[model samples]
Target: MGKIIRWISWLSIDVVLGAVAGMLFFSKLFHVALPWQPYVLLGMAVWCIYNLDHLLDAQKVGEKLSGRRQFHHQARVPVLIVIGILGLLGLVGGFWWFGWGLELQWTFLLGGLIGGIRFLVLKFGKGWMKEFSIALFYVIGISWLPFLRSNSLDWSAWHGLFFLLYLLLANLNLLILSFLDQEEDQLAGFFSVSQELNTVSLILWIKYLMYGLLILLILVLVIIPSFYKLFVAILFLMTLCHWYVFNMDGVDSEKKRIGMEWAFFLPVLLIFLK
Candidate 1:
């Protein structure tokens, strides 16, 4: 049972579910068939690989310093290998189906390479590199969606802005989890923003950041007025669910379980309501 729980935690199931919800929301918002459902699944696989990198690094650090393993030894290596292979396959399959051409594929490949390098660097790099890498991972990963959505290599400001907002929300979710892992991270010599700032200040900052982003989203809705009241209400309920998870302490297992399940359902709700 403990091992099962650990596996679920390492998978970051809530994050994957949230990504699925976001993708579905985008599909509805744009009225695009998003023939890229496979890509979204692939994106989740990539996320699993990226997360495995973190888990491996954490375990390595813990073992070296304390002479005791931190993360589950039996599961760590196998999960990492499996997820890495799946991520690679996902990338290839994504390119093949999406027909984004070599240039765009290369761009996406570069982002994945950066993420891999960042994983290694976090094991050895210092100060700004670590901080910069964390932010970069979020930017690159979220931007991959809009980039993949494009029919050509050419970029547009509208898509770029949307990607940026998506990345902001992604980082917001990550920061919340980082807060929960603050002690473990500090012990592993990881210098996350949550660790650098005071706890209360960190929480306050995250709250304001989320609030500001939501307000901006509202402004966008006002300007476009594309969605209906029901759509807005559904979005609001989704945000409320996320906020509930964000406020929960210590990565509560029950909350994680329930939140993961509900996150997926939000997109389904949008599909029906819209």
Candidate 2:
């Protein structure tokens, strides 16, 4: 039981769940009839490996706590290699399942490589790598390519608004997670926005920024008639809940982080239901 729990924690199961929800959102939005089973399995496998970047960082934290250097520094190399290979396989497999052309597959592969390089730099480079990693995961990996593939380069007011809103919400979510990691990140020498700015001021700014974005989304929905309003609402509520959880100051940080991540599925759910 202990081992199982540890494995689950190590795998960042909540993040995997959120990613699945994102995939489902895409499928529903596109009305794709592809078998979800393969996508789910492949997505989970790919995300699990992608998460090793964080797990490796956490391992370093553990090493700090134990005060004994146990795992070799070279251990992360194998994990990165495995992640790269599996990411390629998952990209090709997903595109194949969707009957998308080789072009889409190549795009995904290239994006994955770029994202992977960012991860590697974060792992080995200097200040704020972790925060940079979070941004890359959303802005580059999740929002940009997916939107480009789905909506194409057709420039329209509604599509542009949607893209902006998506990015705002995603960045807000990333900011909240960074806030939650304030302590651990400070200890780890990770210079996130939370660390760079005054903590209290940063939190306040983020809270209001997120709220403003949500309101803008709702207004856009009213004008443009998009179901994404519901999705944004759900995400906003979850962010509020996350703030509550953070302020409670009783629950463990890890638990709170995991819970917030799990709650991230609400946006995905909304996107799919639309």
Candidate 3:
């Protein structure tokens, strides 16, 4: 069961699942319910890009199969080959389906650019910059729909507010994941913003930021009570995930990562909602 979970995680199926969830969130918020088929290509694109990131990082590891390095030992070559072909196909298919509109095109291109740029910054940037840069990359990657569709942000509507909320959640997700890997990152000589602060300070920062976002979300719910169920579902998941993070002694890091991934997988739960 553990190996199966590892395979699913390493193969980036969770990423595909997260992509669909993100797409659904966008569709629901924007009132633009695009067909589900496009997400397959988008998810594949994400898998490819992530694999490339994995491959690059693997180069820095020793012969040991520690951390994410173990994924390479399982199946490196075939995965990269598939990632290459599918990544290109996903890009082409996306352009063909979503059009070459200025906004959508910029979002697509900028997303890829950010993915690559992150590595360079991580390798060379100051420790203080790591968290903000990481947050920016995820926000751009997961919440690009607003930038893709709008001439300017429309915060008066729920869509814009939801987009910002996604960014905040994305930041929290990355921080929690990094917090789990602080030891591995330090041993590997990698730069993570969490490295700049003591564990308690970092955790406090994350907790305070999340509370602020949660308050804003609750306010949004008050404004649009029709979405009360959705926001409440989110609130529940956020609370659950935070519990796991705040009590890591009772739960292992791997389990915490899975719990957090479920947050990204939250939109999948909407199918069963009333």
lDDT of each: 0.59, 0.57, 0.67
Superposed Cα deviation of residue 127, candidate 1 (Å): 6.9
Best-fitting candidate, scored by TM-score: 3
Candidate 2 vs candidate 3, TM-score winner: 3
TM-score of 3: 0.83
> With candidate 3 superimposed using the best TM-score fit, by how many Å does residue 244's alpha carbon deviate from the native?
3.4
lDDT of candidate model 2 versus the reference: 0.57
**Poorest 10 consecutive residues by lDDT, candidate 3:** 146-155
Residue 48 shift from truth in candidate 3, angstroms: 1.5
State residue 184's C-alpha deviation in candidate 3, in Å.
0.7
Q: What is the C-alpha lDDT profile of model 2 across 78-131, one tens digit per residue?
A: 656767777677756766665576646665686678778776765665444545
TM-score for candidate 2, residues paired by index: 0.69
lDDT value, candidate 3, whole model: 0.67
lDDT digits (tens) for residues 1-274 of candidate 1: 7566455545655456555566666555444455655546645664675567656665657444321134434456776777777777776766766579774567678866986887687676653355556655655553455455655544445445555565555556556656665666677766666556667876786798678777766776576435444445454455566677876678764445446335434755776666
lDDT score of residue 198 within candidate 3: 71
- Cα error of candidate 3 at position 80, Å: 1.3
